[model samples]
Target: MECPNDHILLSSGLKGEEKSYIFRPRFNYSKCTKCSLCRDNCTENAIVMFKEGYPFLMPTLCSGCKTCQLACPSKAIEEDRKEIGLTYVTPVNNNLTLVTGVLKEGEERSYPLVLNTKRRADIMDFDLEIYDTSAGTGNHVAAALEDSEFALVVTEPTPLGIHDMKMIMHLLEKLNIKGYVILNRADLVNDEHIIPDYEIIGSIPLSDDIVQSYVRGKPVVDAFPESDASVELRRIMERVSELLW
Candidate 1:
């Protein structure tokens, strides 16, 4: 399938006045006095000392954790803000829009980008906002799911998948968000007894329709609405609507 004629991709940029600040260290040559303390104590090796008795910061190696600033006895290090990522707004249709957050290359932390993306999306008008968070129950995922009313977790029927699903269930419970599970490739295994306590909303069986739809870059519900997988997905959506609306 091809994109609609009216669909357009826009430049990624920050929208609001609020900025995300990371602890990028800036050195004051006058106040430094060739102490070498900031360079000597940097665990990331981001600070390098030159023969001229001055410290230089390697931008890529810096984690912006302020370790160098705290270690600087001469108080020469100053906190500077740097752009770590960009958020994009894409209009899917008249009724739908997609907001995406992408971290800059070599940046490790994604929480700030996710937060900024959420803020950008929050300003837009929408009756419902659906968040498709990244896999795993890390702090970034938690940050995305913080204000969510419920979470629909999709998992495969496998040992490792079940273990990870349990971890996510625990995280959702801790966050006080109601959780529901949907088993993908349900026909591949008969291990339902080991499933977690979360309610199983739908079980999608392995289907060639799903595979072909994925290969064609089309949704199964749109490409093959009568297919078994699509039918199950519709049921799941109905359940979700009942719970949410």
Candidate 2:
């Protein structure tokens, strides 16, 4: 994630002190050589020397200034720019469009891709724009769901799924965005306490037809409208349609 490393300078009154803060760089240990050059050059004394002679950063004390990067002989210090994701826009129908983003294998950052994909959707002329954000409450998901009127968080009934569902719910509250839950694989468990506080838009039971529709390159609602999961999906759509209209 490329954070804007700008320092906020504030006036200090006590003893002519200046208050400033900035986001420091996180070093890539794989690329860094144990030369200790970066540690020696850091004016803030943020970098400490390891027993192996390699330098590690103390993020709190480090300023956003690139003095260490400029002074390093090996050029090991580099800006964090993980451009390993792509935004995809596909027209599902005249009324429905799908804008998706996928991070490349081994890449962890997801916000940029989400932001880019949302920008693509914003450009299109449509009455109701829907955004399906990636899981988690990280800044990436926040970037995707910013300014959204409503959000639907889908989760399974497993332990991990329930844990993550609570996490996203808290995040929705923090962002002041109203959210509803959709419990997938509902037949697998009977744990309603996982999301006791939030409203459940719909619960979709496990069904083979739902999987088959995906394999057939068709939406489950379009292919098997009578299925249990498909019916729940329609109910969700109807609720959303009512809210929008």
Candidate 3:
């Protein structure tokens, strides 16, 4: 696969353990045919092909930044962008669009796909955008929330959910982004540990109505606007808009 920025096919490799490995690129110049182009154009000096014909990428020493790709004439350098996944743009309504990045099956790296989707969305003009991120405090979630002005984290009321919520909240705070919590099944958990100052942006009590609407691919706001759950969602959106503006 070609690197999105450089459009070159240099090298590709896996990161992390076997069960959780992700495909990434390793820029190799030994495969390069004396391409001074990669050297001249490399912004990070990541592609260092010496006169003796030894080329190596200092990935840690190097940033994943793509300056060399622009300079390589041989098109020998490439990226693992495809190994990450595909991005799809689906029209939601007149005012909004839903852009999703689904990882190819068996692929372990989901962050690049999210990054690609966000990049595609960034160029388009839109009045409102809502990103439904995957559950986790990993690179994928980080990338999904990167450009968002505000985030609404949804969680169920369970011990595990609360534990993960705290971790996610810490991550948001570290990123210096403001976010609110939406308790998906608010009545299930005790209220003693719930943070008082932290905004309880919305609540959707466990209900057959909400589940039926979700199964029908309908937004709760559209299906049951008068319902308490729908009302809470709107209130949350309003609060989010206020913070964003």
Candidates in order have lDDT scores of 0.78, 0.68, 0.63
Candidate number of the best lDDT: 1
How many pairs of residues in model 2 come into backbone collision?
1
Per-model TM-score on C-alpha atoms: 0.78, 0.63, 0.66
Instruction: For model 1, state the Cα shift of residue 232 in Å.
Output: 1.1
Count clashes in each candidate, considering only residues at least 3 apart in sequence or on different chains.
0, 1, 8
What lDDT is reached at residue 69 by model 3? 58
Candidate 3's residue-wise lDDT over 31-67, tens digit each? 5677576566656665566686745665433434555
lDDT of 1 by residue, 1-245 (tens): 01111112222222323434466988888888777888788888988888877999998888777888898888888878788866667765578677767667767777777777788889886789888787778887898889888998888888888988999989998999988999999887776677767789999999999888766666788789999999999999999999988
Highest-TM-score candidate: 1
Model 2: per-residue lDDT, tens digit, 44-80?
8988996876677776466456777877777777764
Model 3 scores a C-alpha lDDT of 0.63
Candidate 2 segments exceeding 4 Å error? 1-83, 191-195
What ranges in model 1 sit over 4 Å off? 1-23, 33-58, 65-75, 78-81
Candidate closer to the true structure by lDDT (higher is better), 1 or 2:
1
